[model samples]
Target: MEQRKEITMSRLQRFLVVSLIAVFVATLAPAALAESYKFGASKPGGSWYPIGTVLQRLADKNYGDKVTVEIGGGTGNLLNVMSGKLSFGLASATSIQEALKGAKMFKGKVAQAKKVRVAAVLYPNYLFWLVWAKSDVTSYQQLKGKKVNVMPKRFSFQALNQQMLGALGIEYKDFSKVNYLGFNDAVAQMKDNHIDAYLGPGEENYAPIVQLATHAPIRILSFSKEDVAKMKAANPGVVPFTLDKTNYKQKNDVNTVQTFLLIITNEDVPAERVYKLTKTIYDNLGDFAGAVKAFERVKVANATGDMGAPRHAGMDQYLKEKGLLK
Candidate 1:
């Protein structure tokens, strides 16, 4: 009877311990699951898609259970971040600068961009226009009467468009038909011969255009020194660049303007979470250098560049701790 009693007590104690652990895990599930975030990569046609993918994988690999990235892009990411619908997303430094001023790109949505903050600098991009070989279009002047997809709708992209076109002494009305569409749609339509030309501004060897070239056999329109000068006159941030044919599938080099890209968040995110994320990025910056063509230049040292938006307090704290902040 004594042996049986001892055995029964041991079994009871084991059952009680397991029950307590089950309850503890159940209680923590909400907070654990709540850590996941929706990030915007824009459409599949751009660097945001692929670069964002690599960034997501790197973050998840380091802090997978604490983070999740979603597909999104353009002003959608900015507006969503403003609305607290996203944890963060990618956007251009120029547009974010304009948005912070409550004019230019963001216009009436100053409140939205006001909530926005920079988490990291992804890379820089350059603007280049392309036409199909069959179009017989040789210059920006020839695009005056043709249907054109300007790539940037109105918000984040409009500034670049205005700057580039203004330099050329042209406007949206100069085109017979103008559409504000994503890079993916523009590439698809161009491939089908639905559009005459595409005005694309992006990182060197942007995937959508690079992919489009493989099957479409396209050509980038060359800019004259006077046109480039006028473009530079429009935006000082806009610098002259040359895209090598060997890199982007063109027969020759193409001249364009350059700008920086960034990953952005809003003030709504908790400081701890943002700090943790910023930590993950800088700790693994070297691993991301060659994730994609444009990201090759990524450096933890550039984490504090003039991204035109305020840095999230969490991000700033991490940078300060690392002495990465000046």
Candidate 2:
């Protein structure tokens, strides 16, 4: 009996040791193997945030909790990705071009811009220059002496605003007052009659503009063909777009310029990793479109459109594997 008891104790000790080892390995395995990534999304009250959230859900779910979404803007995302602070983020075609050339918005960041790469082309963003219907400001030229909300500094919208204004021979100093605010804040200021005009980019029926229209009648200022031509000449990524009455309570379709939205990533991201992400998104396009209506326009064929940035190798590999690229 004494021998048997000693043998049982020894077995129990061995079992406990093995159990502890198993627990220890289990606790560290996920952290050791998971590929963590920081995804930069747009700020609050913008469509990019929600779109990024959807991407986060898909990436984390499929990649095993590897991605974390954070607030970012178009120009900021490009700069951050180039700086390696973000793994990937949203940008616009025009912004990418501007950054690459160190012109307009980017000014002096040419070398750093090379560090950023295009992951995918998502959709088009329409420029909206809004005013109260009661206001006598009828055209973009009239915005010269009016207070305007150009969105926060470093926002792609602000850069685009300046570019469009510059094309028409207008300057920030020309405005009576310039307020750098975000979507919600800008809309609030406009509704309160604190600002004479507000400008930004968004898909049709953008939420902030829609909300503002509900509170008070608003008009979408249209760009003349000549003005658009000048902008396109300066920014090749700029394209003519129209917002029909269905988009807002307007008398006719509002003519504006648009820029293609892109997913920009750091050049250091592994090609295999980018391939995985690209494949995952393409396979789940329906899910993305369902979550974000703007994504309904996304297509695998359009993913490789020129956005003035070098395409990542992983994205190329995925395209090749799918016969989308040779």
Candidate 3:
């Protein structure tokens, strides 16, 4: 009996040692599997920033600190994704098409376009032509000979502004002074009357416009049929949209043009990781929609919509499991 008891104690000690080793390896497994991915988003104070932040938070929750979000412009996002500088980025569908076509700001980078792929289609971004309500500059044509902020150079909004303005026979030279600024700086300049107009594109109730309006009433320039036709002629991606007074109270609905926003990924990202990333976002979409009003439109049905870029295989697999794709 004494010998049997001693043998049992020895077995117990071995069992405990093996269990501890198993636990230690389990703890380190996640860290071993974690691969860092860089995510690019729009500048601070813009809608894309918050959207990207929410995604980053979700990724951190699901995969630890394997994903990092960085500030990037629309055009820059596409370029960086192509160059493998970013694993993924938020970009407009129009800009993706422009990159693929080597058009507009993407003139001369067509070869790199093949590296970009669509991860998800997020929402629509409306082109906002904002001027102080009391200012005399109410029309796009009236922006001529006036100091204006056209966003930063090579920005997707700047490209859109140039395209639309080009259709109307307007150019940066036509403005008394053209300032290339980001969202916050443009809003600040507009508030101080340093700029007569600010041409940029963003989701409805974009934060910068909301902040600018609190200082002084601002008006969103409407697009006429002729204007829409001209813009569409310049870029087929331009679509007519009616901006209602949900966010900004206007007496009447404002007519404008809009483009879809998408999440783009580099072709080299692993299919399994992309699948997990898509699952993370799709599973916690409520958190995203809660953070950004624009994200409310993100749905499984629309997540895989054509955004002028090839769909990532990982995203496709997730959509297929949801019965969205064959």
Candidate 4:
């Protein structure tokens, strides 16, 4: 009888150990099967790249393990994702719209347009101009006929700048001189007081803008309700916005216009994998905010903001799971 009781106890212990092993494997099985990916982003020092680095860092610690990030052009990033050549990319909603129609920057209708999918809306790209605080440029309208650097021709910011001017019924040709200069030259010209204003968009605490503020008190031009409406009217994806007065060296909140910046991927990735990536990002935004200032504005409400391209089935599923898709 004693021998039989011992045998029974031994069998029970073996069974319990096997069950725990099976449960552990079940929990981690998906991660083991998870696919690695490359993230295409803008050049280093640009606002977009920092977000990508944070993304990969979190993904590597989660399921999108060892994800590779690349610095590349906007059009190529989105196109590569759709073609399955890249795992993911960052792009603006407007650019994705153009690609869908094979218009503007794209030669024709993109062959892989259908595969393009949205992961999340990172933040809105705000467009405005800035000058030293002592300068008398009072409003966005006042900049008309002033010597301004609207960024150079290579960045494709020229057309966007033209749209901002058109909203105010001003033409690019109307400026005293529309200098197609780079950021460094713009800052140099600003310090020398050679230029009256520098008009462009970037993160509120954009390094160059912040650097300029260090040498001279700077003021970013603010848009009125009516002008913001007109600008958004002319541009479909843009939304009216205001900067926090307390942050980024801003003395008062300034009104502006914003276009959605999207994290995009393709249909080739499995639904479950994309779901994990989307879920992780939204859940861990606090961790990423440390990497860039723009992150402070990444609200959950904007997670489902329209991005022209359809949402990946995986991302959509995650949203639905969290009750964010309603």
lDDT for 276 (candidate 4): 72
**Best-fitting candidate, measured by lDDT?**
2
Looking at candidate 1, the ten consecutive residues that score lowest on lDDT are 62-71
Tens-place lDDT digits, model 2, residues 1-326: 99999999999999999999999999887656568788777787878887777777877776665677888788888888888898888888888778888875567888889878878778788888989988899888888889999988878878888888888899899999999999989888988889999888867767888788898888899877887899898789889988887766887888889998888887898886777677777888788777667778888898767777788998899889889888
Candidate 1 lDDT over 3-44, as tens digits, reads: 999999999999999999999998876557445777766666
TM-score of 2: 0.87
lDDT of 3 by residue, 1-326 (tens): 99999999999999999999999999998777777888888777777787778877777777774667888888888889988899888887778767878886677988889788888777788898888888887788898899989888757888788878989899889989999999889887888888888788856667788888788887888888988888888877778998886656665678889888888888898987788777877888788878787777776787755667788999999999999999
| Model 2 misplacement above 4 A | 1-33, 104-107
Cα TM-score per model: 0.77, 0.87, 0.89, 0.75
Clashing pairs in 3: none
Model 3 lDDT, residue 266, Cα: 85
Clashing pairs in 4: 102-108
lDDT of 3 at 89: 85
Runs in model 4 deviating more than 4 A are 1-32, 73-76, 110-114, 134-159, 166-197, 224-226, 244-253
Q: Residue 254 of model 3: what lDDT?
A: 84
Q: For candidate 4, what is the TM-score? A: 0.75
Best by TM-score: 3
Error in Å for residue 167 of model 3: 2.2
Global local distance difference test of model 3: 0.82
